[model samples]
Target chain A: MSTGAAEAAWQPSELELSRRSVRRRASTRSVVIALISTVVFAGVIGLALVGSPGWAVVQQTFFNLEIGIESFPAILAGLWVNIQVLVVAAIGVAVFGTLLAVLRSLRGPVFFPLRALATGYTDLFRGMPLLIVLYLVGFGIPVLDIFPRLPAVVWGTIAIILTYSAYVAEVLRAGMEAVHPSQRMAARSLGLTHAQTLRIVVIPQGIRKVVPALMNDFVSMQKDVGLISVLGAVDAVRAAQIEVAQSFNFTPYVVAGLLFVAISWPMIRLTDWASARLAAREQSGGVV
Target chain B: MTVLEVRGVRKRFGDHDVLQGVDLELDAHEVVVLIGASGSGKSTLLRTINLLERVDDGQILLGGDDITDPGVDADRVRARIGVVFQHFNLFPHLRIIDNVTLAARRVHGMPKDTAHARGLELLGSLGLGAKALDYPDRLSGGQQQRVAIVRAIMTDPELLLLDEITSALDPQLIGEVLDLVRQLKSTGSTILMATHEMSFAREVADRVVFMQGGRIVESGPPEQLFDAPVEPATAEFLARVRHH
Candidate 1:
């Protein structure tokens, strides 16, 4: 496989060579353009901020490296709380939300009450702000004294589940409805019971179809878990609040915010990957 | 012995009477074909028998059991019959093997190994043994319809209902499906099918039923129905089908 022998064996035509060169030039030009645009945008924003009159105060309060470093341990530990709440609430939301969706989608007169209740639950929770639900459940439940006093963290986690399950249920219902009616007809014609048809045929496909939307909701849920901090639970944001109160600096808040972004970035990428895979599968006519 | 009996089956979708006082019967080992124009109630009649559509009036009996009675369990009644539809109704998420084995395993409570073996046997007989592991989307439309037929027959129900099974197929593919149906007819399986393929009706049907305006206008042996139809509507419909 000498170089000259290989070149002779596989000689490129003039048209092919020109086309290759053109493609190469276009790619290189686009890369250069992208780089220049990025540099200009970043430099302009950086210069404007540095040239501003309040830069010194803003930098000292928000970007102090020492304060950020000091806050890391507490914020990281508090982030563990957010993680626990997120994982538990995610599981709870999936189960409760699917149940609500099933109830809402039931047909005939026998399930009318259950359907109404599910509709009311979704409407009431989805209409109210997550923070208000947090306030009501976090403060209101313990005061009622009907149940034993649970930790504020537990109450906060409940609030997140309550609000998110409503949205997740709606997403699940939409996915289930999107399954063609022919599927149900086929299942029933095969002698599968209504329950069996839903379990064995419909729900599995429906859930797969909604995976991207569910992942999107889960990512938002990771952030909403931070809202639990308003209940005095020591989640990352609450820890940052404590640090800011003690030091009179906002750098800890910035650190906590960055940590939240760090946590959600992987999930966002995961959702993008899942959606792309789904699109590709559909285009190729592959099974879900 | 009669395998299925439909007595005065009536169905209405809003104001339109889709099946108006339809009465039909199928004897064991008989292959009956229903032919009609679009919206002529062929599908609605089959659907009513399968319990996919509730009849507004009349009783449907399967092997002397009044299946359309309000107290009757639809699921249990459906288990005793097999049905294929106009579209390929294979479950998309499942492999061909699983799709075939599902009703046998779940409804009949057949063992998994038994179902798998039976599914493989059916697929192998149909020249689809290698595709059992593949999902429905991987197969051609004709293959998918064949799998649907296999799935329907897995439980060996008392009767099989096919609703325009070969209509969705390409012209080249229709023969393979029709061949499978013909093979089933030879096996003494009782079938009541609705189809637009007049040639198939001529070949496989022991009795050819003609429907128009949601009513059975005429029915007889294929020779009488196709070559010597007594009813003007039947002759006109067959003439139109032949013109196309």
Candidate 2:
């Protein structure tokens, strides 16, 4: 078709074409505005960083690259701890949260009470500040003589599980409910029991459907583990804090932030890759 | 002896009575087709047989065993009776073969290898063997419905209940799924299908039952029921459906 004929066929009216063009222009303009704003904001932040004494100290401390090599073992250990905390907490949250979600979704006389209880648990933990929860678990529990002998690491782990389970449960519940009711009915008609169907079919599909959300959860959880350092957990942040005290300088905190960025940056990229792969799989009607 | 029986089956959804003391029976290897207008309790009756939807007051028997007994294991009863839903209801997460084999493995305790082989054989018979590894979303409506049949039969059930299995298919696709059902009849599997397909009812069914307002209005051999329906309601229903 000729360009004029094709354009006419595609849009059909001058009004529609004008409206489309207006929207396209508006979107492009907004994108340009956002880019400019971001550049300005980033430049200001860079100037502030350059003017700070911490930057000079950071430069001086890392002036000998061999110092980094010597401290590699400590840094590696801290990184491993971060990973371990994330994986253990993630697994706990996924399993417990799924069970709670399933229990919340069950019907009949038991549904309301179970739902209310699950809701209460989720809301209570999720609504509280994570740092407060960590403090309460790590300090208040001992004062209250409730598991007084429990270590700070144990308290921190509990705090992480409690706070994140609520969030993860909601994500998983949304994923579970996204599956069509027809799928569940099909499972029932096929004579698979409810538990068997969930284990073999529903949860697997739900988990796949919520991969990106789960990855986001893990990424955030990794950052939140740093919060536990305030309770004397020897995480990367706590180690950096110790270094800052010894050097009487703030450079270690920046190094710690970089360390965190190093951990979360790959996870964010993984989330993007996983999200795209999931979208592709959904388009192809299979798991990628 | 009747392979299936539903007697005094009454179902209520809160205050509304869905099935008001309905009664029906199916004999071994005989295809009994239920013909009805909308709200005639056909689908409800079929669902109650498998206890997917429980009846408020009723007794359903399968092979002389009272399935609705107070202490009876409902799952065990359901496992012995196969049902094909109108929407096909293929589990989208599973492959076509897995959809079929799941019941055999879960309900019947059949070994994975045996269930897989039997499921594949059933799929092959239904001309869906090549698509066994493909997910349900990859198949056409008719192919999915056929795989539904294969899934239902995987437990080697004594009776099969089909709820308007072809109603959701395109007109062109309806024949293919029905043809699969027609092929199934020759295998000597007892079937009780709820449908509005007059030609299929007339040609394939041993008995035709006409229902209206949640009751069986008339029933007879397909020829007698279709050619000379006894009740005026039956005649009117047939005429109305045929007109549409």
TM-score of 1: 0.95
Chain A TM-score, structure 1? 0.92
Best by lDDT: 1
Tens-digit lDDT track of model 1 for A136-166: 9999999999989899999999999999999
The list of candidate 2 runs beyond 4 A from truth reads A1-76, A108-117, A141-151, A276-288
TM-score of each: 0.95, 0.84
The per-residue C-alpha lDDT of model 1 at residue B125 equals 99
For all candidates, state DockQ relative to the true structure. Answer: 0.78, 0.50
lDDT string, candidate 2, A69-92, tens digits: 444456556656767777788788
Docking class of 2: medium
lDDT per model vs. reference: 0.94, 0.83
Docking class for candidate 1: medium
